[model samples]
Target: MSRRVFFVTCPKGVEYLLADEIQAFGLELVRHSPAGVWAEGDLAAGYRTCLWSRLANRVILHVAEVDAANENALYEGVLGVDWSSHIPGRGSFRVTFLGQNQAIRNTQFGAQRVKDGIVDSFRAAGAQRPSVAPKSPDVAVSARLHRNRLSLGIDLSGHSLHMRGYRTEKGIAPLKENLAAALLYRAGWPEIAAAGGDFVDPMCGSGTLLIEAAMMALDIAPGRRQDGFGFEKWLGHQPEIWLELKQEAERRAHEGKRARVPTFAGFDQDSRVIATAWKNIARAGLEGIVHVEVRPVESFTRGEKWSQRGLVLTNPPYGERLSERRELSTLYEALGETVKSAVPGWRMAVFTGAPEFGKSIGLRSFKQYKLFNGKLPAQLLLFEVDEANAMTPRDPDRSGEIRPRIANEERASMLRNRLKKNLKTLGQWARKQGIGCYRVYDADMPEYALAIDLYEGRVHVQEYAAPKTVDERAARERLAEALAVIPEVLGIDPADLICKQRQRQAGTQQYEKQSATGEFMTVHEYGCALRVNLKDYLDTGLFLDHRPVRYWIQTHAKGQRFLNLFCYTGAASVHAAVGGASRSLSLDMSKTYVNWARENLALNGADSGKHRVEQADCLAWLAEKPSPDQRYDLIFMDPPTFSNSARMQGVLDIQKDHATLIRQAMRRLTSDGLLIFSNNFRRFRLDETLQSEFSVEEVSKSTIDRDFQRNPKIHRCWHIRHLS
Candidate 1:
């Protein structure tokens, strides 16, 4: 009957929400800490919390607080507790020790000490010692140590409250039930449900959000479906009080089913997850209350019979991998469009680990909350689908002009003018030369530092990394301005634009994929067809600046045995093979690129036994002595400026290792064979000592095509040939 202190724990960001829930249940608030809250409550209060609190992970009944300066003190402090009153004779128990200090560095050690203390206390009293049970113990004790002080308690909530005994099947990354409830609370779902509003999740993986929302709307006690609580077996547990609480919860749940509940619906692209969601929904006794289907976000549509006002809540993929991140951007954009068109005037909340992708949605979020999805930091973005927050509709007449939505009109005009001028000049040249892909602008103006390239009808923009001295905010705003102007000036849809930050790449970073869309488009260069993926890598499959070099190889490769080293996607090899090379071999360390090269060759009808594509470290492969059959009449070596690939034998610094690489390649070259070596290292200086060793000539000026005339230093090339 006396008031006892209790500690309630929840997820990191759900402390405040849990505290509010505790107070709603008539428990007096004592204090709050990170991930937990202390409350003053009696046995009945604890029972009610365990039965009704939706956001709590566990409820612990505080027993005592004692000084624990060291291991000895920790053991004595735990031993001083009256274990006989809580643990029954012959009952199995477990100790959960949390936090660490210099005295007790390991949680396992602390738990062992606590167990020893409890066993010794029971033995000293001539009582049967309770057995230790790691799983489903009769008594679960919690010992928390902080600042040399220990607080020991009896856990009353067995097995986290998040396990509602319904979600037997889950997706790859299932959101916890408690966290899903917290998101609903933050998104104002309770109030919306009270007003008879509906709920929808377009990308719902396993329907966690939908189930949680349905429970809230129907007033179903979250703990009603729980198997049992930790307090059920404790000797001090009052069976009458616990029975009354459980009976009340059961009555409320029975009544809630008959109450007016809001519509709860979800859709996922994966039918497997949707089937799992249906099983979960059926287990929760909401099979008819909740509806789900296998529908992608693009096909998401509101039901004609559903309420017009509701919340569109979803936890879309966070794109943990770099490739997924780029691909998810378009997915997020589609979600935003779906929300705007399908649920206009409704409220929406998106929980994502990559918050930057929220901008892709085009809708401005009115509120943001920082939360953690497990260990990953995440954000909950709230938006109202009203006109004020609606995305600016693209005007048909102004489609060819920069949108006034950009704040800096003057800067926008400048970028637009520069792009127009470049397009007028280079556009004409590209058409006459039958080039479908080329750079239209390469950071022509310092303020707008972006390389805008056109591949057929699509546009790829690479924003050059700004100097440290430049304000990052200003840089971002300028990049936004450039993005806004480039699409209009190039006469392309904004959806066709793929923007990425271009920084100094090192150690095969450029070769790493930025996305996994696998959406490749074929573009023409010198009448040769090549496939380029604009959404995937930092650099498209085909490098446009190397147009002249590939052309030169095409013109002079007639009847020559060609070799392409560091051949990315085998673009150069495709050119050589098309130019009548008698035979060719392309070598690169990346298996992905090797497969891509084979695909590219097949796309151009160049994949034959005569032209082989092999995956091997060019540096290591070149170190081996080439046989007479392996020698080639002409060789092209374009190694990365710097690569420390684990596949490679050693680090490669183009400036430092070019001589060795060139010499290795020249060994495979015939006496009259020519070796075209090139790199994009701006500050590269060819090894001067090579002049006396071989016939070397700087052909950088001649290799640069018209599209790269403005940036002549984009790459450096050298012609190295064996001297007779």
Candidate 2:
């Protein structure tokens, strides 16, 4: 307790905030560095910081600082640290070196030098040398080398503080426990907790945000459940001081009043994540405080009894690099809409790494906090959503009179810059190749740009956005200007370019439309279409992202009977029949799509003798036909993410029923047959334990279309080889 101790504090930026926090505990900050804040405090105060500092990465107690310019100096300096007092005679220790100076070029070599110094010191003292523990150590010694000065310290927190022990199950893309807590803290949850506002994470993945919020609301020390602290093993360990800190933390928890522990609720589209969130809630012992449900954002109407002032914190998908931002654009916009319509008085906090992606939500962030997830710098964007609009009593006559505000024009300018570069490079090649049709580019989210396809020297653009929302028509006009510039900039005839808008569909609408060139292609409920060129759209000739599995079927379908389920335009079956399949049956409940599939077969010169396209409910079709005599040899199964068409026997959930579908498909497959099942669900996880019945090899690469390279997980295909 008498020794001069340096406290090393690592926080996720906002050092002044942490310094202020330390100062609040009566510890004056001695110095500050990039890695942490340096303060002179006794062993007791160091332990206190580990327990209370909400933003610190970990706390370390300095053992020694010495002038160690060379290898010998480094060794001698480390040996002089008096390790016997900190670590017991022969206790295990790990030396982690953060190198910033000339003495050490490599971190490992520096660490080794420190290790040698400690070992040699013990040996010279006639005491046994302790072994090295890398993963976890009885004692953690950190060595920072800068300008020939060696600063060594003992890590008190042991493990990274991010592992808060609450999350028992990991959903797809679950936020790291520590990062989640940091996000909550960064979003000003502490103030919200003190103010009496509730917290809700509608897109909760494993209840991270909800649990973190609950801990904040209840004044629960995140480290309360932690079993050990590094100071316990130090030579000057003070049991009474540590106990007092813990008791004080407990006292605060008991004394904190949250206006009746404001209601915390989490909702997810996936039942699995909901179940995982439930387990996590229980693991955190917060089952009574936190509630989670399986519900889509669209179906999530605010609970009638809940307060309107709660904070809405969520980490919705950025779609990552795996998904096309275009595919999830509407979802993001819909979420923004939901927040504006459903939760009228709530504030919103969203954390995402993609800047372009943040714009996709349409709601401008009031403040953007820079935080990190491991090495990736992320922005915690805060939105002061005026749910006043949602709660407003609608005037039957005046409700439609409110004019919508324009989206940030700056973002559009940024998009224009990016499109300029892309067009400057790819436009000329497209026109010269007679590729009048192609996907101009895909929008990230919320922007909802028209999918431009050039057909017969004219642009067929599909404007996919809500009707009369903002300056959507203005965006279309900007796109038209962009399309017009493409031909001239690329040295193509300006007369060859024209623009037309493809109307947006609601629900399960389908239609065939002729463009300016009179070429007809089928369109589905989504803005996605089956076109034959590269100039007018972001994609042409069907979504090629599904190419790999389609080709997988073509290669395996020769002379084999095939069944293409969820056969959108029967693209896969056409590939199969073209590959000389003996017979192919395409099943889709959409009659328009069934006819489209037949047209595709005709376009490919496929004969009707071997091809049969049927409009039937896939699930019901499978149920009615029990025998395997007329079973398929090659089955192509691709399902919608979530669908509840009246033609179906029941609502289809791809994630929940994939195992059953795979099992059923396997039942109809020949001994050596291949069943290719796929889904476009971005975060789809296969039933590994269930799929074990069949040899399932992922054929994602084989099924990817060349045009869809930007979006790898546009669909994921698995090749099921029936157990022979």
What does candidate 2's lDDT look like per residue over 603-667, in tens digits? 77778877989889888777665575768788888877655444565656676677877787777
lDDT at residue 470 of model 2 (Cα atoms): 48
Count of clashes in candidate 1 = 0
Q: Stretches of candidate 1 above 4 Å error?
A: 320-323, 392-499, 502-539, 542-596, 599-724
lDDT of every predicted structure (CA atoms): 0.84, 0.67
lDDT of 2: 0.67
Cα error, candidate 2, residue 69 (Å) = 7.0
| Candidate 2 minimal-lDDT segment of 10 residues | 504-513
Give the C-alpha lDDT of model 1: 0.84
Judge candidate 1 at residue 205 and give its lDDT: 69
Each candidate's clash count: 0, 26
User: Of the candidates shown, which would achieve the greatest lDDT relative to the real structure?
Assistant: 1
